[model samples]
Target: MKEHPEGGTAAALLADPRIRRRLPTAGTALGAGLAVWLLGGWRLGLTVAVLVVIGDVVRRSRKTSSVTAWQKSSAAERRTEKQLKSLQRNGYVVLHARAVPRDDDGVSDGRIDHLVIGPSGVYAIDSEKWDKRLPVRTMSHLKLFHGPFNKKDRLDEARWEAQQASSILAARCGFEVPVQPSVAIYGPSIPWKVMRVRDVDVYAGNRARAYLRRRPKILTEGDVERIFEAAQQALPPKYPD
Candidate 1:
């Protein structure tokens, strides 16, 4: 097994050990403050230096290094998987990185991050790790906007994935199976407990277990077993190569 991770972008500015270490970070702030002092005033420069120091402290507290999008997503999945462990103990079945056919969805690459089925019926969950600097909010419960980016396409993709799962399970189980679509986001705080936007449930990634627990439990033990069997066969492991 590999000890180190993969796919991390090395920022040119952040490559220097001087910039990363506390003493050097303080030195850089002092330099900046000195430059500001010449242009503006001493008080203004002091304030700017203090702000820079505080900002660097906060950044180091949050993360030590820069990571690519894939790295962030992989981390988010791991965090969510940890949350799903309790669910597994409670008779729930969780499938990670299952392949769901595009079926002309036009939105996804045929991937369901986590498919959970238990007492709350079925769920197709997509894990997301967005920038914490941006605020996450829903517009009238019909749209989700993260900073300036609209998440309509993502919502649609999740819904389509769940719909495809529902179709496959229904065909094999010989009954209608409704799979709830959801997006479990990490990093940025999700302001709402559970919000339905464009037919997809959205919540914080850490709330994975709690979210299911709060849902209306309608599936019996037998139903969970049968559906789990069907899904295991129908949706192959995405990483099975």
Candidate 2:
């Protein structure tokens, strides 16, 4: 199993120039507020100080939310990657954070959380770190609801991503590569061991490995290599050398 480097989304967000710019602006506001509080009249100074503090608080809140989301996503990716590692001894090739093009124009839609190629077939896995506070409820027509948020479309998106991966591999290998879409729900209180919605597998974090392991073998050793090669060629490198 070839291990592709992780830290794609989190690293990109951290290295973003916009974040660097915001830090200095926030610092300037904090310093100016302190100066006003020390030299100006108490009433006016207090007002300015309070306003600045509120602004800073809001800014920090947004930043913290982004960081927290990234942390959760990174953690989920690591957990799933660890589980997938056990498959290497069984002739599975795993690729992490593989970018799949969603359009014919060559623009990437998003990166597949994990791509697994083995004797069973190809899989395009999407790892989700959903809030565990709210229980996921399935309504009519397999509609999913978490808290107040409707998550039914997530399965559709994952299926589209898998189809895109299959198309890419098929074009490269001259044969249809059936890519199965799976959503590994981490940090969620899922009711079922494995839930299938629109043919997409939705399973809890702990059961991801077992769910994948249960897949029937469909490809040979040579087929795995061929599809893996095609994947490497089609997807972008997770990290730059």
Candidate 3:
């Protein structure tokens, strides 16, 4: 099977030394405890078995939480990547998991989930896996509600990432590069396929390709190549060696 980019949440988790080291200990404990229960008497055997089971349960619980988080993040990214690949087939230049440096110390910051340049425009896309059970509700003043919780700030973060991309491209190209901010929401029960909030375009993961495809053409092929090259130079490498 093809591997996801190294920067992906799931990939990073699986590659973590700590997680890798701890996961095997649980299985070893279970096996050892089972062997001791068979060889030793009921009293000592039961106590050892119970203690090992409890320790294993706690360890597994922590690992399960990390795995669940990675699954959600990886699923969202994978969904967005599939849609972006469709855009590429239609002549879009797409970049996945582009990490940019923070302004404070030039250290690597979070990645832009996807970056696309094509006839429509340049887009800095972020993918999110929100709760599937809760219905997304758009409120007044560009706010978004899910059940009783407010989640308007996610849009703000997407817009900021777009701005960061725009700034990087503009600096590279010596002119303004209008990068649209977009959020591809996965695992959310969205009423509509697409929703626009001020400057950010929000859409369900499956509909993101169509949403971009339907946009008005703003860049030519030459512009797309130039912008893609500039992005490649400005953004950090997508994967480590």
Candidate 4:
């Protein structure tokens, strides 16, 4: 197995606030301009440019809030990485914002913030960086605080992504591949909770990696490799060609 880099580097890159904000916005603007020029006229291109600038400005204003969220998600991922490293010190993979299998919506919906598929089993982790205590319940649907408002839908989306991916794998491989969805909160403000729903485990910032490591084995070495290859092919590039 190839050796993997330290979790700190991946975490730092993941935590880097600019990639998510600046690079994508720039790329989108460029793409829009190119499309407008090729198919439409200068007027359409100019309009796109104007919208791009406006979008950038709006994003700049929201950078602080976005950065805060990024930090939390990265923390949980790094925690999960620590355990994955133990299982296979090297060759353990961590893919961030990987789109769900077979996405045609055009929008990158239901991203697996941190996906670790190793000798143990496949883990679909959702990182939540929010303030306030989350109440633990046996039921999956529950409201959690979100600043001035309460947002329960934040982490549910991740779980749904995991489910969809699991179904895709099962159909492709002719076996029920278990995709364990876990919620890892990364913030001092949010209180801890331990809950289970439809086999998905809900946990807080603390012990997230440990929790993932404890999951039952669903794929062997070969099976893991096959799934990883499939996911790699399905993953969208961070940068454009």
Candidate 5:
């Protein structure tokens, strides 16, 4: 079970090893070798194992590194969902970890985390699960961190997601609708100032529900319901049935 109901349950299912489907168990890669040594010979088995290992390595090399902003964001979304349940008594819906459609630029891509399609315009909550202090300047792409940090946020990744989602949604509905972008932070001592980054809302995962409550509704209950229904139909196949 997910920590919270809503979308988190689905997200947890996708992340589960028992439930999640891997591409394959190298069956195709070792099929030829296994066929050649169907007599269960030890030497054939060793050869098959080696071939499988090589195939696995080659597959790994072909794949883009798993370290991505979207993967990192999902971690934050999980934390935020738990926090949302604590703070909001009612009037908020959670979709958990449903992956969004891929954008033009191929990447891991994010699911519309914890969709808050309330009276406010549809909010595509993006999670940022981070630790340590960050010295972010106003209207700048670079974020300074402590302890000899060498990594930085990728360029236009968040914006690209928001824009892509908005365009796809608008096209689907035959109406121009704005999708709000938010960053949910799951970290110790999250600074208040960072929440106001370039007028884009950022909040600690724990504060998400409360933070949302303070904002005016951009969509009505009916509108929220419509978006929710549409989202369910549009979720990727990896999501729960």
Candidate 6:
């Protein structure tokens, strides 16, 4: 049975400080409607009130979606970071928003969402937030389907990011650093705990911590520290503040 009431999402939204501040007060639409009624007919006044309410709702939705969606994609990373906190005490070191040159052009394509180094070896995890309404399923081990959209490009990108990190870390650390590529999907129900699809690991976001822990510990503590330090220097912060 669910621990909380069924309207938990609605309750959480009502409680969020950011969303609460944006909630329309009682006077807005009513005041506007009254003003219109004084100037025009009741029909016009009703129309004006409806438009005002709709505008307010649309504005709030836009702001919230932008903050939580791809325009501000860091929300997924932050979620995964909290989930991985227990790993710290277990000798795991995590790097967030790390950037490295994608190629000889020296331009950074984008930042890796998370880089994890510790006993389970090095991992480059790409945290994703997809629409919950859409069903995520794989057709064959080679193809991933999100509704009707194929995620071949996304899988390829994840692999490339891991390979890039592996190359840089190996060159800097003077040893082979095989960084495993993985994706932790949020906002949708992933059918599997962990699966290797198109050479990259995929799993539900809730399994982020367990996903890494389930792997055998291949590196000693000393090796972990050296690579963690090297990764810090090699993969500079994408958004240095």
lDDT of 6 by residue, 1-241 (tens): 6577658988988899866765564367788888999999888988898888888876544343212333344567777877777799888988887886664433335678889999989999988889999999997789887889998877877888899899999998899999999999999899888888999999999899999786788999999999999998989887775
Against the true structure, candidate 5 reaches a TM-score of: 0.55
Write the residue-wise lDDT of candidate 3 on 97-117 in tens digits: 776654443322456778889
Q: Encode model 5's per-residue lDDT on 39-107: one tens digit a residue.
A: 777588768867776877665443422223323334555456656555334455556556666656554
Question: Which portions of model 4 show Cα errors greater than 4 Å?
Answer: 1-86, 90-92, 101-108, 132-150, 189-193, 197-199, 237-241
Cα lDDT, model 4, residue 224: 80
| Lowest lDDT 10-residue stretch of candidate 2 | 64-73
Query: Where's the lowest-lDDT run of ten residues in candidate 5?
Result: 64-73
Backbone clash numbers for all candidates listed = 0, 0, 0, 0, 13, 0
lDDT for each of the candidates?
0.84, 0.77, 0.74, 0.62, 0.56, 0.82
TM per prediction: 0.69, 0.66, 0.65, 0.53, 0.55, 0.68
Q: CA shift at 223, candidate 1, in angstroms?
A: 0.8
How good is model 6 by TM-score?
0.68
Model 2 lDDT per residue over 1-241, tens place: 7644576766776699967656665677667767887888667666775677588666554333112333333767767777888989888998887776565533334678789999888888888888888888666537777878888678777888898889889999999999999889887698888777778888888777897786778898999999999998987655433
How high is the lDDT of residue 27 in model 4? 78
Best by lDDT: 1
Put down candidate 4 lDDT per residue, 117-213, tens digits, no spaces.
7766777877666544544333334544445454445545656778877787677766777777777766544334566644556666666656655
Task: Show where candidate 1 strays beyond 4 Å.
Answer: 1-73, 103-105
Report the C-alpha lDDT of model 1 over 48-71, residue by residue, as the tens digit: 899999998876544421222223
Ranking by lDDT: 1, 6, 2, 3, 4, 5
User: How close to the true structure is residue 149 of candidate 6, measured as C-alpha lDDT?
Assistant: 91
